[model samples]
Target: MPEAKREAWITGVGIVSTLGEGADAHWQKLSAAQPGADTTTFAPFVVHPLAPLNFDAQIPKKGDQRQMENWQRIGTYAAGLALDSAGVKGKPELLSQMDMIVAAGGGERDLNVDATILNGYTQAANPAAFLNERLMGDLRPTLFLAQLSNLLAGNISIVHGVTGSSRTFMGEEAAGVDAVRIALSRITAGQSDIALVGGAHNGERPEMLMLYEFAGQCLKDKFAPIWERGDKGGFALGSLGAFLVIEARDHAEKRGAKPLARLSAVVADRASRKPGTITETLGKLWDKIKDKVKGGQTAILSGATGSTQATAEERAFLEQHGELAVRATATYLGHGMEPQFAMNVALATVALAHGSLYPPSDQTGLEKPMSGSLDQVVVTGVGHWRGEGMALVERVG
Candidate 1:
């Protein structure tokens, strides 16, 4: 006989966004349809800047906070919040056994060093030699050490004391998809009893905006909701941190941990993104758990990054399921790349716990009033470039 699958439950969620910190703060703001973005700060490019946060509350060590970049500090702080939410913070016994999965992107670059090299190359007697000399001597060794993607996991381990098996995945939005997918899968397969999963993005950086702008994916000259961005839709990058604590249901019960919600299943795929590929892949992903999605109680919490092809293709897929109420969270949180999917899943859990979806904040016909009790949530993730994924989160009680 085959072994039955163990249930996965979301015991805790920690997210810090432009709206604020924790689930309660976000609920209060989003519930009132007050989603704000800073258009003037980044100017031509819109961004949802992170709210004020005290690193001391989480990292506690000045040396630890000083060595890390803003993005890492954001992630480490969020991880501490998740540990606290799970009732495991400072408990070495529970933390020592907890696993961790982080979705990460490359660390920030040294723009000052880059600028010096760029200016010197034009005026140097030997441009090539000047470039090599500056590259070797100008950039600090510690800067490169801070750039590795796995350091987020390392810092989380050091700060929060989650010392069990650790893994970090990269590849933008797809990383977020697989991070949660694998965490839920492991819990369900009885391989891991508890795991921390999520990522962070620092969208306030000039280089990021420049990079996305080059790809023609940055929203410019005015901010609009994701759905209403029209023909040339683009994503407004968001500066935020998101993390979740997922564990086996039986294990949570044994530890006297209350499950905020059940992670029923997670499915992911890399869509070729040509023509109708995103729509087709999303359809297939939805099939993996469509049976568990209850009609009136279910709604879609979309991580639609508002990039042209991706947003349009995801919309095409959503049109097929027009009956399902959909809220593209990028309309509010903006798009935080590797962490967007996890953030939406966290939002879904918060909404489910509240028994109602937050009020609509956009003029787009796509986002409508829920008009029903909430229980099941279908969180959709469509990477700006390649991935397509869906996860089903259901209310525990």
Candidate 2:
């Protein structure tokens, strides 16, 4: 990696998850080691549901809220919170020029329409024609528009008044890594001064659970902390929204914005999942940022999703760095797919700001406590299927 001309600082963070909304609530609840997973509602498959939220707080217009899907609303509310935390909300001068990068999944399925089609298709004399007819007749045109992945960025722009350039990435967990990586790189390379980057996941939908279930990738029957999920480990889906306002250090200083943490280095890779590739990819990413690490003061915030192979491979890599205190955040937040990396990065920033690591939530002895003052954090993100990324977030000044 070439030397950066500027420094990147995380000036603001906004997140809503099973614990609640905002950084303080997350910190307090995570510190207490509480996991908000609900196993019975979805039965067999476990999930961490989003806490009760009044969308009116962040999105005032009922019409605007009505048009967006639950995922879009969750993301828009989080974006508004990030702007608020940065003290730039409603400030037309700044809002008009702030760039945005969002990691998102395709539009949500209209279950009612999908079910109606599925039920009628099997009984029809001509299945293909019947399917096409139902798709054309029963599905509204607006539903197709709503399924567009880029709509999250559009909704955020409409709701938060962010009018700068916008880009959206769509590859599940990998998307979150690249969103932050590109934002940080742009600020460092002088392509942009400030940016809003993150994503959201709504894991409570029956479609999502059914989809993952078909692939045998979801935790079923009971919810255990990530580390103890056993050999056939699977992820417990979680509903969450995470956004971070990262700005060039000088740009923030010029605007009188305070820094929450310094975003030092971000490295991402899509390792072909052939046996040991994930471990090798993670190691290479670690080598890129390992030199900046301070021995005892640095802790790791892992985005391990509790999937069998992925989580185990990440554990192998972590074993090599046993000197650092490690905490697998999925134990509490569960896995939020597209937003998991951003949430872990936000949690790391929150921990760095407080100068301490949150208590470990695992029982396998894989997660250890940190007694010394925290200064730097190395975040690891291994997607449930394909991507691998690592970022170094440190205490600023």
Highest lDDT scorer? 2
**Candidate 2 lDDT tens digits, 62-156:** 99998889999999999999999998899878888899999999978989988889999989999999999998898778768889889999999
Instruction: State TM-scores per candidate.
Output: 0.97, 0.98
The TM-score, computed over Cα atoms with residue i paired to residue i, of candidate 1 is: 0.97
Report the error of model 1 at residue 370, Å: 1.2
The number of the candidate with the highest TM-score is 2
lDDT, candidate 1, 1-397, per-residue tens: 1232998889989999998999999999888887779989889889999999998999999989988999999999999988899898998988999999999999998888989999999999999999989988986687778999999999999888999999999999999999999998788788999999999999999999999899999998888888889888799999889999998989899999998899888888896767999999988888778777778878999899889888988999998988888888888888999998999999999998999998876786888888879999999999999888899899987
The C-alpha stretches of model 2 lying farther than 4 A from their native spots are none
Local distance difference test values of all predictions, in order: 0.90, 0.92
- The superposed Cα distance between candidate 2 and the true structure at residue 296, in angstroms, equals 1.0
TM-score of predicted structure 2? 0.98
